[model samples]
Target: MNPAPSHVASRRDKLLILLTVCLAAVLLPLALSGGAVATPAIGRDLGGSPASLTWVTNAYMLSFGSLLMAAGALADQFGRKRLFVIGLGGFIVSSFAISLAPSVFWLDILRAIQGIVSAASLAAGSAALAQEFDGHARTRAFSMLGTSFGIGLAFGPLMAGTLIEYFGWRSLFITTGAIAAVAFMFGVPRMRESRDPNAAGLDYPGTVTFSATLVLFTTAIIQAPESGWGSPLIVGLLAASVVTLVAFIMVETRARRPMLDLSLFKYVRFIGVQILPLGTCYSYILLVVMLPLRLIGAEGMSEMDSGLLMIALSAPMLVVPIAVASLTRWASPGVLSGLGFLIAAAGLYWLSLVDFSASKTALLMPMLIIGIGTGMPWGLMDGLSVSVVPNDRAGMASGIFGTTRVAGEGTGLAIGTAILAALANTSLAHRVPEGGPELSARVAEAAQRLTNGDIAAAAAALPEVSRHALSLSYADAFVGLLHVLIVITLLSAFATFAFLSRTRTQGDGFERDEKGVEAVTRA
Candidate 1:
């Protein structure tokens, strides 16, 4: 490939910037989901328990989601190019370091560091794109970014399976590190430096308090399934989350220059944009994290087979966002977003009806429908979220949007797993009522294993007569969880529809201030 154009002044330079920024976006999800297919192998090799293995994913998410706003604020204060290069370098180093981690503890710690660095890269990279593009070009640039993100998510499992089969799980990190290093090398000299000239000093107190709130809350959610929800530790963590949240709000309110401008919440349009991603990502995460496990464990498919099947769930994401962006001339973004949520809810409802004994092909239509629906709003919402804000605070808006996306995925995974575990246990108890105390213990063990996507172990642990029943119970639990998700998604769809219905035009609900910066207002 030829060298990337030197600066953003020429048309070719603009395309290069988009590609560079999208490279970062793609790398984030690639690093995140690349390990999905390798999780079992990692656990087996590292001697990690199911609960501990989950932290391997959650640790990355917790740190990534928690630091995004602060990272964005820093990017705005410092130059975006400077922070982007630093973040890319950190990601490269941490990715390499993770491959050398001797145990799960060190791996999780390194993954958390990777997440922190990823936050900086994502926020700065996105801000750079926003700075480099405008109008229709901006729309197309965001669409391409969304497409790259979808491609990463769509192909991560396939890549992971192939890499792990050939080179082992360690290669995943090594490959990612090498890619980041290359991107950094190109990004450093070619990328133009940009920062908010009016930005004040970093809001250290607000960042600390806000980060504590997210950490405590996510920790409580992750542990609630293992430790009883009513446990003192869980309760204390919940309480601490609340306290830190209040402290964060107070700090932001009093700060001369807040990390997050709390006043943005007053805009109904901004609120709608924020909620759009949270709702869509919740459902998307469930599919991404759970579907592969379900195929491998419940359906007895090979990792490669499962990865191929996942294409139905993610390929539409690659195509639909660009298509939706093109439709902007015909439909308002609010209309498109609300319709997307409704369609996704319908898809989830359809998925709830699939029979457990059905073949993998039976999942294709619902998965495709859900993928298309999920893709429809992504680029639209992403573009609007940053564009609606002042040009200088684009980083802050991008950070908030990215934070919601990661936080929603983490929250969904925790809740979905808990629901599946609880429901499976309940079904097992009902079906095996006559089993002795030992049998009851065995069934509980099996349910836990099933929740972790070790359906083979779960089945093997049960008596022959109970094995088929266990499969049915697993199916029933999944269906039950799907029903719950469907309901939540439908409620979100209704709210999105209601919010959008109030607007008369594409930008009717927002107004430009005296300085020509957009602000949210009533239609």
Candidate 2:
């Protein structure tokens, strides 16, 4: 073949940057969901108590979500390319170390490290694309990036199940490490370095306060089910989180160059765009986190079978981004996002009607509807978040967007899990009222086992009569939780509709003056 023209070569290089960064982004969620499917096998091999296994997921989410904004600021102040390379290197090392872990302790520690570094890679990679691409190219780039994320989420379970069934659970980490290493090799050589020239010094107090607040808040939520919500420890953590959050706000308002410019909140459209991801992820992604466990434990499906069923939930995301991107020419982003959330809320309502006895086939239609609805706004929200801000602060905007996304996801998981645990325990107690302390203890143990995706072990721990009752309770609890989540999602959809509907179609601008920030006239 003839060598490509210089212009063509330049285009290819830009595309290569997108390709490499997207690949790196895929690794985080792939690793997350992959671990979800393989949790049973991992617990069995690692021999951890049920509570210990929960940390495998919680640790990663807590670390990843909390550090996102700080990482974004660091990338903007330093160099994006440099941060991206370092993050990738750290992720690769953590993955490898996790694969070689001798115990659950090491695995959890390494997973937390993976989450921390993944934040750096995600923020820098997103900022890099936003800075490099513009106009329609920016739209297309974000759309493709959203598709890549959807693909990873959609296929992660299947890949994890297959790996666990044949090669063992360790292979999941090994595979992730290998992929990150390849991305690193490609990215370090061709990636163009960029940073904000006017970026100010790091806001140390703000970073500490913000990160500490998230950590404390997320920890309390994750542990609320085990330690009663009103327990001293939970209350203490909640109080600390509130105090730290206030400190963060005060620090940001005073800092010469705040880690997150509070002035961004003045743009109504920016606030709406940020809320879009949080609402969408809360309604849609939480299902992605819980459905696999439901299938394997309550529904008595194999890991591979559960993974296949999850395709019903994830498959629509693969194509919906491109479809929505095209639809934007006719409809405003607000209309599309609002309509999408309404559709997703409807899907959740439909799912709430499904009985515990419903088969995987029965779930297909509702799951597909939810997937389509959620996917519509996925890429649009991401693009709007960066577009509304100055290009120079793309890194910070990207970080904030990512922080909301992961934080929303983590919060949803915590809330959903808590509701499930509460309802299940209540149902179980009612069913076995006269069974005595021993049986109640066994039932509690079985519930924990089920949450960890060990259906067989949970069943074996109970009498046949108790087992049947337990399954019924689980089903009832799941249906009840769905009802509660549906209400929350509907309210969020309405709020999204209200705010987004008010936004101007043409882009808006921001101007910083000596004393105050001004919103430029919309074009």
Candidate 3:
């Protein structure tokens, strides 16, 4: 037989490299999104406070989100394949361990470990993938990784719901672990080792400061409803987060080899690329977690029903490749991304107008619209992350972009949960007429339980209030939340367009040569 063309062999190797990372990508969302679908069920099985139940999801995100930049730096300092093996090894162990957690507290701890390991896996895998591809081939590769990620989000809920209903919630983790293990077996041998040659050492000071900032910020958000936003603890947390964030910036600026190059912010288009993930955090990620809780908790939908509804919201991701191809052909990325954000904003507005009493199907159209809009940017953001930076700093690009996306998700989810709970508490405030401090505390606790879909517990706490009344209060708060989300989405759309419209061939001040060497260029 005739030997295969040289290009064909090269293409096959690239595909194999991509498949490994794509597998790694899918696990992040599956654990986050699919794990979210199991929250209510998990809560029912292992009774805990609403905050604890939220932590079931939040713990994984917080740990994963906070460590991503450090993980990226490690991948660069070490070898990508080496980090990949260590991370996956730990991840596999944590997944099975989390399945056996006897209480919410233990589950939270194990999930946090799972998240940390996942961060290492994702950042290493992504940076490695970027190293292997160049030019348009790289764009297509990242797009495919994005699509695999979308697949995990789009189907996670449905799979979790079905698994929880029949096999129990533990089955979700077991299944994810088994699938991830299989991917590890198939892909590891094929993945060539890669790393950033210019990596100076791990930026310990920068990593510590950055990690502290997120922990403090997320803590403040989660504690605001209970401690009161003005409480000293919450005030202290917010203040400390700001201080550490400033410290991180100062450290990065002074360091010879910063984990994030502060100079990149000078480029208008690079700033816009960073904003893309921030937009999705509010527009898409928050919705994926919030909508399911609302469906099951407020509307009393079954696990299966909520899962099907989420499909409408996330299913548009299935067409992300087609959407990217068509939209990019007809318009510049600025137009495509900006238009997508506006579409999502419109969907949020339409959702706000929807009556709670309307059929679940009433949510389908707007949810689908929101998904389509956000899906437009989903595939492009990953490409833009590395494209804007120099070829050598691909590791930093992966770290910074991944941090923004994951950290933003963790931060947004905390804020969304707090705001929604506060709104519910406010709605219930009038109902607690003639109450003292003790009663007020009870009301606050009940409000949290109600938002988490634990109506049975909330009703017990407020025996005088009917379950229907509690549901109505939760629904009222949800509508108000939607209005807030709409405003955020619109502002994001305007900012995306304004910043991205000014893109240069190199978003920053670097140009690539035939061998992927980078040199400084004036903008």
| Local distance difference test, each candidate | 0.76, 0.77, 0.81
- Across residues 331-418, which tens digit of lDDT does each residue of candidate 3 receive? 6676677888999999988888887567878989999999998887776676677766676666466667778888888988998899
Native-to-model Cα distance after best TM-score fit, residue 330 in candidate 2, in Å: 3.5
lDDT of 2 at 515: 30
Ranking, lDDT, top scorer first: 3, 2, 1
lDDT of 1 by residue, 1-523 (tens): 4345433246666666677778878888777677666666676578555566666777777788878877777898989989988888899999999899899888888988998999889878888888888998887787677778888989888877677767888998999888877777665566789989887857899889988887888778767655667889999999999999999999988987777778766656667777777777666777787776666666667677777878888888778877887787777776787788788888888888887467768888998888888887765777777655556566567667767777767666767777787888788888765867678667766776677667666776676436677778888888888888777777767777766544433334334564332334442
Q: After TM-score superposition, what is the CA distance of residue 379 in candidate 2 from its true location, in Å?
A: 3.0
Residue pairs of candidate 1 with colliding backbone atoms: none
Winning model by TM-score: 3
Check candidate 3 and list the clashing pairs.
Answer: 297-453
Better of 1 and 2 by lDDT: 2
lDDT of 2 by residue, 1-523 (tens): 6556877977878888898888987887887787677667778788676656766776787788878877777888899988998888999999999989999888888888998899889878888898779999997887677777888989888877777777988998999999999888876677888888877756789878987887788778767665668889999999999999999999989888787777767666667778787777667877877787777656767777878888888888888877887887787777788888888888988888877466568888888889888888775787777766566666567667777788767666666776777787677667654777678667666666666666566677665446667777778878887888777777777877776764534343445552323433221
For residue 312, model 2's alpha carbon misses the true position, in angstroms, by 1.7
lDDT of 2: 0.77
Model 1 stretches with alpha carbons more than 4 Å out:
1-18, 130-140, 386-399, 431-445, 456-467, 504-523
